[model samples]
Target: MEFYTKPGDYDPINYVPHQASHGTKELWKTFWLLLGITILDFIIYFVMPASGLRNVIFIFFGIVKAYYIVGAFMHLKHEKINLALIILVPTVFIVGLVMGLLYEGNAISLMK
Candidate 1:
């Protein structure tokens, strides 16, 4: 399929230049926020004690980073809330499943 549009035949309704800058700003803002989260994760790695509490902190930061990355980079934030929720709900369920399995494994190991 031919992807390139003819020079004068561009569709302005579907692609508006004025609104494009807004998206760029959001992208950069999300990038900076994710970088900050990464820095915090690194700081926690060294300063926090190696305990379950530290694990929880890392998981919280990881979730925040994932939210922004998916929302902004994936362009889901621009879509309707229902559409975003449709994609996000399954993701959250999968994370829950993994957490449950890890908890069960720890419990079984402790019982032995």
Candidate 2:
């Protein structure tokens, strides 16, 4: 069929939208925060004896880092609440499922 109406109509193939460049301040902040969390994770991993508590601490740190990464890098922080919830709610359930599986698996091993 016919796509363009007139001589100078908008061309779909050669459309170039102008995107404003957001500065690097927020990116630098996110970088530093992620780096700090990584350093903390390493320190805790080395200093703490292997135990359930240590595992929980690592999980908590992981969630925190994931949140920051999604918020800053993925631009979820600027999105609507409903959109954010749509992505986060399933993640919460999955993490719960994993924790439950770990607990049950450990219990089963103890019985063997």
Candidate 3:
């Protein structure tokens, strides 16, 4: 019998369930991808450019890493496209707003 046959049995805040293994190959692939992303992030941090361009590149890589983390490692890629968009839309909007604010703040500071 399934342990979590009933959906309500899972707690919203602290429920931890065993991950469904997608076999050894998938597990290895996920690990390798994660390692690669970490390396890329380290490289970016060391090669830091000016703030504006650096942030843009960092955010770009961050989004890519997030995509892989959510889609591949977390096994959500096969789900509906709308589900993925739902998770990302707010994040994208917030990032855009932050960037706009930063740009505006820099402009204001320069005017002084």
Candidate 4:
């Protein structure tokens, strides 16, 4: 609200900032990214193969999607390399555990 100068005049010094830009570009970008991931997921789900190629392709796409989400969308690009690696420490351990389990699984089947 503006202040009255002399009960008959109003002060014009008071003003409000301009409203933010009007656009939906960012929203559309996010929507498209999500739609793309959804389509990839559907494709991965219905297609089945007995060879290890399927697993390799699945893992490749999974890593790509993860990198995009974490590196670009998460705004982690400005972070230091050490910081990023610190966050990835858990992934390293998880991958190691998965490898160990796969080895054990194969060994057990062989023993049987």
Question: Judged by lDDT, which candidate is best?
Answer: 2
Question: What local lDDT does model 2 show for residue 78?
Answer: 74
User: Can you give the lDDT of residue 106 in candidate 3?
Assistant: 94
Runs off by more than 4 Å, candidate 3: 1-21, 47-55
Clashing pairs in 4: none
TM-score for candidate 3, please give it.
0.60
Please say which candidate is ahead in lDDT: 1 or 3. Answer: 1
What does the lDDT come to for candidate 2?
Answer: 0.87
User: Which lDDT value does model 1 have at 112?
Assistant: 100
Which candidate would rank higher by TM-score, 1 or 3? 1
Top TM-score: which candidate number? 2
Q: Write the per-residue lDDT of candidate 3 for residues 17-106, one digit (tens) a residue.
A: 556556778667777887887898789888886686877787787777777778776677866789878886787788789879989999
Q: Is candidate 1 or candidate 2 better by lDDT?
A: 2
Can you give the TM-score per candidate against the true fold? 0.71, 0.72, 0.60, 0.58
Ranking by lDDT: 2, 1, 3, 4
True-vs-predicted CA distance for residue 17, candidate 2, Å: 10
**Local distance difference test values of all predictions, in order:** 0.82, 0.87, 0.77, 0.70
Error of 4 at 8 (Å): 53
Alpha-carbon runs more than 4 Å astray in model 4: 1-34, 44-48
lDDT of 2 at 17: 50
RMSD, candidate 4, Å: 11.5
Runs of candidate 1 exceeding 4 Å displacement:
1-23
